[model samples]
Target chain A: MNILVCVKQVPDTNEIKIDPDTNTLIRDGVPSIVNPFDGYALEAAARIKDNAPDTKIVVLSMGPQQAETALCECLAIAADKAYLVTDRAFGGSDTLATSYILSKAIEKVEELENEKFDAVFCGKQAIDGDTAQVGPELAEHLGYPQVTCALEVKSEADGLHVYREAEDGKEVIGVKTPCLITFTKPSFDPRFPTIKRKIAARKAKIAQLTAAELTSIDPAHAGLKGSPTKVKRTYVPPRKEAGVVVKEETVEASAHKLFDLLSKAHVI
Target chain B: MPNYLKVTPEIIAELEKAAPGRVVTGADVNPDYSKDEMPIYGVRMPDVSIDAQSTEEVSAIMKICYEHDIPVTTRGAGTGLVGGCTPICGGVVICTMRMNRILSYDLENFAVTVQPGVLLQQLAEDALKHGCMYPPDPGEKMATLGGNVATNAGGMRAVKYGCTRDYVRAMTVVLPNGEITRFGGTVSKTSSGYSLVNLMIGSEGTLGIITELTLKLIPAPQATVSLMAPFEDLAACISVVPKFFMKHYQPQALEFFEKEILVSSEQYLGKQVFPRKIEGTDIGAYLLITFDGNSMEELDPIVESASEMLLEEGALDVLVADTPPKLKDIWAARSSFLEGIEEQTKLLDECDVVVPVNKIAPYVEFVDEAKKNYDFEVKYFGHAGDGNLHIYECSTDMDREEFKKQVREFLDSIYRKTMEFGGQISGEHGIGLGKVHYLEEAAGSVNMGLMLGIKKVFDPKLILNPGKVCMKL
Candidate 1:
């Protein structure tokens, strides 16, 4: 079986700083990382490959040249092949246009490799934009079924068994081959890359695809011109004040104090 | 033994006058004030405890204690491993936790003056906000900066940046007689009179109480990368430590631990960050190293060459942790080693001994051989770069008293061997009540006499943290 995992490089949110005057993100010294949820998505694919050694995992990303670093990381972890779909025409694309371009790029990738991907994996949402529309939209564009908020995935003789997070708990669903899955955080963290794999990843050839090469993606329906939404402005949210800590000699006393305080405040 | 007056209601009234609403007596005093992290040494509740908020308050409290001839124990967060902050004499415990504050910053001199009660973690984080760093990174982040200075704490970064003593530029201390004085200053270099600041450091609260501190800070590093190298066994892993220094790798931190300890730490953390097997070979030990610099361009070649050298020196594989989360995962496990050991063991005792860098392998081997003669399980890890090893002897099956007796014998053997190897019995932990005998044995009478004399001069009544450090009582 072959899988294609989509990843994105975004500034580490914990280290993010904002320019007070411009009310915009200060990206100068901030470090970029593979979106954490995308790492979980790749780990989900890697675990499947762990069970079936013959499975080939390919990593795909859409961004500027620096996005290749995220792809290389995926390659080092488990990916067998890497592709960066970077083009000036794809700049400023919103969720709708991104899913459309990615759907077209998937076809191009299939033709280039001469193999159909058995499954497409993606993070449920990119942390930076957090639109969460791309994966489901991509599945709709490709006319394939998809599972979102997937906590885990297992490959069996029947098909892919996906345990998806629900409002109450988790619900298991079986999807056929050629399906798409967008993963959330699982119970386990992704494994660290070994030195040999890290060295090899630095030397791995990352195939770059441009707008012209993806023939199915029309120039009119790509980039900023095709996007329906635009962010007018951005600003840092105000930080909340530190909470009060109640400590008594015993747990019962502490609880009583908390209950009394909440009742006095009309919160309980 | 030194005679000391008990804390009477009159003394409590005097303390309340100095630091109103902060004094507690009898059952109202916090039980934690009776001991530090290590209760194995001994514990005794103070007759009175006061949370001092300033140098004046500490001085006033000391004046009352001094005139009444009460033994005063100064405590911080009470996170010390060797009972350094334990109020074992049942007099008065003057705690500095309430004095938590960052006093000032002299950017021109690259110094930040802070209240000793401020936590190490608080200062470390606050320094980063100003593009500066407090370099002393002891494992116990919640420990007070005052306690760190009092113990002259040396941490993982001691390999590169030295210890808390290296960072301390100045401090305000209250003497036993309630005299407030300043030591050192914000100046970078000093050729002034007797180095009183140096003397007060690592005194374990026996000399005076540290109320305020001015510490040196450096510009934060632009980039950092950590490497984990697994070897066939501890000997092979540790054999590569000196080679890194010989090769001028200048690692920010260098640590080595056996797989068994790593397993216990991972189990404690509920996460496995390091691989136990690589290429079908079970890894018996690992060396965790870190390098920091202005840019990756400068560190890349160093990392590459170091990786090559480690592999050549019997390392099975070297793994890189360049990202923040990866670094946190590895370091969190490394820092929790003591807590992990403590969680599973009913009785525990450890020694933080510093030997010559070259003597680490042989000393560890000697320890391994010696532990076989005892029933308790032995586990160890250390800053391989500086030759400071934290060796712990623990047991779950033995009776408390039996474990204590046997461990005492075991430690006696260990410290004797340490002295023979020309090593110090206490590295960063300091000679608190727990290791006084070993310290006396290690330092001998002549050196011990000088230390005791200095204590007598600084604290003539021997009323400050009585029965601690060089004190025989």
Candidate 2:
């Protein structure tokens, strides 16, 4: 069975600094990184490949020219191949447009490979935006079975058994082949790429496909025009002002004052 | 020439449906998730990021990825000195920020259970509330518990309290197979088969993802005194460290700073640490010694004896201060040394090399002489009691690229010298991405083989933070 993994390149949010003047993100000098959650997806896929050596694992990413770095990382992790969907027309695409374009790109890839994807895996969400909508949207568009917030996965001769996170506990679900999955954090700790694989990934060339190259696509279904939501303003939240400090002469007095403050704040 | 991995619309749709509200895609990906504190390297951002609050959430995410075969990287506060936290591979980055809750604190057992994302400073403050202290202070106040465990970080207090590994009583780790297993426990000691807890301590997030940790705490020092002793010559200061140990002064902390480091530190703290400047006198080094005990009466004799010993051995005046604020000021200067060194250099790379206590003098002399041969200026300071020294090097007149090359050579030479004296390549900072190559040399062939074998046993898929610590898999 052929498996596909969707990965994306994002900015390392920990290193992000906001442009105070404009209240917007400062992209310059900020490093790009692979969405950390994708490692679990890759690890999961690699496990499946290990369990069945004949299985083929493919990685897909959508981003600018620099996005190939993410694919290279996947290759280092033993992904058999990688594909990049990059086009100026795809710029400023939102989750809706991204899912649409990626769906098309994956379709084109299937046709080119002359095979069908048995399953697709994705990290539950990206850290920067925190808006986890693409995976479900992609699953919806493809009309395939999907399991979200997955923590555990076991493959059987019939299909796959997955453990997903619920509100208070976990829910076990089984899906047949050709399903999609969105991983939850701490699912399985992602594996590190071996040295041999890293060397191969470093030299692996990523295939790039522009919007036009992704088959007959409508111009209206690309870029900003295809995006349904637009960000209007961004600003940093104000710093919390220090509260009044009540001083007391003795430890008992201080404790009473602390109790009073807690009472006033209704904390106890 | 393109090596392409396939993604399908069916998979994307399934992922979206599964995670109704958390997934991020396309231009929604922000830039801040890309890099770490390492100054030289540029950013490499993740395509998607996730904030997981529970083990189930993490496991669910892993199950999906396992089916499709995606790469993932884990991140904490991103205060890493090396590139270990950078998702050099752009996939999913699981941010532990939301998982920062202190789960439990048992004062009786002297143990605290905390989520991996909890900050060290927060833990220290919380521990202090109960008249206890978490002694593993790694300088960076914002570093997370998980990051500390990942790196097995040590700091000035390591001379007394030991590093993170010493205090880690238990851990909840997520394996590559998405299994959340508990290792070790609240029990003080264990003789388990593999000691997976110890193995994971300095694994650099390769073996497993640490979700929660139970750390041991100690009673706070009751009465503390700090002293600053100025030496007329560098040899005297270096020679006095081992003497303190031999005399059994039992100092909680013993640190040494050269003239350059002291002056820079003073400037950084914006306060005069030394009573008077000994200018043009070629004063080589200054030592800061601190003693802590249960009572002032108990500490007074020890402080007096240490002072008398220093005076007798070095013939230099030793100033002792017991006032809280005054002692705090002196410590502030010492802790601010890293920033001061950064302020004084155009570019700097630090070597956290540790040597045998007796070899401290020889190692310092060797590094001092080697400085003249190198293309950069070198400054030395650190926890002298533990023989762990931070030797920082920066460009003198060379360009950036040349300076980096020379810095590598200088560090290589120092590592060689350290090994000859039975020393470690890193005393506090674990073998993150920066020290991977050196770790191989330091661990030698036999140890490296064992480490690799263990890595395979714990992480068969090699999916945990790749390219860190033990070379890939």
Candidate 3:
């Protein structure tokens, strides 16, 4: 079985600084990291291959050249191959255009490998954009059934078994082969990359695809020109409420008080 | 023993008059003020706890205590492991934590002036904001700079950047006579007079109270990388540390510990980052090394060579943690080992002895062998690069008296062995009241007499932190 994991590089939120005058992120000295959820998505894919040695994993990302660092990390962690779909024409793409480009690149990747992927995995949401439309939209474009908030995935006889997070609790659902799965954060971090793998990853050449090479896409339906949505402006949201912490005699008392308060508001 | 004056209402009133609302007495005092982190030594509540806010306030408190013939123990955040801030004499414990303030920065001289009560974590963070780094990185980040200076505290980075004493450029100290005097200066070279600054650095609060400090800072390193190497046994693990220096890896920190201790930390933090086994073999010990340089490009070759060296020396495998989050997790686990042990053990005693780096493996092996005859469980870990070992004797099942007796014997043996190896009894933890006997044994009568002579010159009344360090109370 072969899998393709999608990853993205975003500014590390912990170290993020905002420009006081411009009200925009000060990215000058801020470090970039592989979106944490995407790392977990890759970890989910890696774990499946860990239990089943024959499973192959490939990782793809769409960004500028610096995004290759994220893909290299993906390879070091266990990706069998890496692809960077970067082109100047793909600039200013929104969720719809980004998903369209990714779906087209997924097809191109399939043709290059000459093998159909058994599953597609992605982070449920990129932390920077917080727009969760891409994964489900990619699945729509690929015409494959998809599951969101996949806590774990296991390979079965004819399909894949996925444990997805639900409102009440986890709900286990089985999906057939050639499906797509989006992942949230896992309990543990992704495994550490071995020395040999890290050294090899540092030197590995990533396959880059351009808009011109992906001939199936017409310029009319790609990049900024294709997207109809526009973000007029954005400003940091003002913090309106600070959380209230209850001081009680014991934890049980605190919990009871919290439950009573919540039930009074008909939330429980 | 010297007769110590008791705290009276009159004396407490005088202290309150000196420091205003910052003085607390009797039942009003918090229990934490009675002891330091290592409570096993002993605990005694001071009659009056004064939160001195400035050098003049400290001077006023000291003058009152001096006139009353009361012993005064200056305390910081009370994070000391050697009872250096315990206030065992029990007259007055002057806590300087509230005096914590960053005074100024001399950018030209690369020095920052701060109140003694300013914590290590605060100074380290504030310095980084100015694009400078304070080199002394002690494990207890919450410990105040005053306490660190008094103990001459050393930590993980001591192997590379040196210790607290190396960073202290000048200080304003209030002596027992209520005289505030300045020591050294913000000069790169000082040879004009007696080194009073160096003397007060590790005097353990016996001579004077550190009021303010001018600490030297260096440019911050651009990148840092940590690598962990697991070995089949500790001998193989520790023996490879000295080789890093010989091969010139210039590791910022080199620490080695057994798998069981890591398991304890894992339980405490509810986080698992280290492996218990590798390649189907149980990991006996791991050597954690950190490298910092101008950039990752500069550290890359150093990390590669160090990893290769460890693998050649019977390592299971070398793992790299160049990313910030991964490195932070590894160090968080390392820094919390003391808390982890404290939570699990009912009775605990620790000995921080620093020997020659080359003797670390043999010393570790000797401790392992010596534990067979003792009833308590022995857990040991230390800086492999600096040769300072924190070997703990712990027991949850033994009676308190029995544990105390056995631990005494155990400490006697360890301290004796430490001296035989030309090692110091207390590496970073000073000779507070708890370990004065061991310090006496290690320093010998003649050397101890010199220290006592020096102590008397500064504190003639012997009222400042009596019964600690070289002073015979």
- Please tell me which predicted candidate would have the highest lDDT against the true structure: 1
What would the per-residue lDDT of candidate 2 be over residues A28-115, giving only the tens digit for each residue? 8676767877767787888778778998999999888998977987886669999999988999988988888888888988988899
DockQ of each: 0.56, 0.01, 0.60
Clashing pairs in 3: B2-B473
Q: Which stretches of candidate 2 lie over 4 Å from their true place?
A: A1-268, B1-32, B41-43, B276-282, B396-398
State the displacement of the C-alpha of residue B434, model 3, in Å, after optimal TM-score superposition.
1.9
Model 1 C-alpha lDDT per residue in residues A51-78, reported as the tens digit of each score: 8999999989999999998998888788
Clashes of 3: 1
True contacts kept of 2: 0.00
Among all candidates shown, the one with the greatest TM-score:
3
TM-score of 1: 0.94
Off by over 4 Å in 1: A18-24, A166-171, A230-268
Candidate 1, residue A126: the lDDT equals 90
Ranking by DockQ: 3, 1, 2
Error of 1 at A232 (Å): 6.0
Give the Cα-based TM-score of candidate 3 against the true structure: 0.96
Q: Which stretches in model 3 have alpha-carbon errors above 4 Å?
A: A238-268
The DockQ of predicted model 1 stands at 0.56
lDDT by residue (tens digit), candidate 1, B1-473: 78898788878888889989989899998999999888889988998888888899899998888899999999999989898878878889989898899988887788999998999999999999888989998889999999999999999999999998999888888999999999998888999999999999999999999998999999999889899999989999998999988899999999999999988988888888788888789999999999999987788788888998998999998888888888888899999998899888988888999998899999999999999999899999999999999999889999889889989998999888888898899889888889998888888899999999999998999999988889987
Give the per-residue lDDT of model 3 (tens digit) for B231-346: 98999898887798888888899998998888898888888888777868999998999999999889878888888888899999888887767788889889988888998999
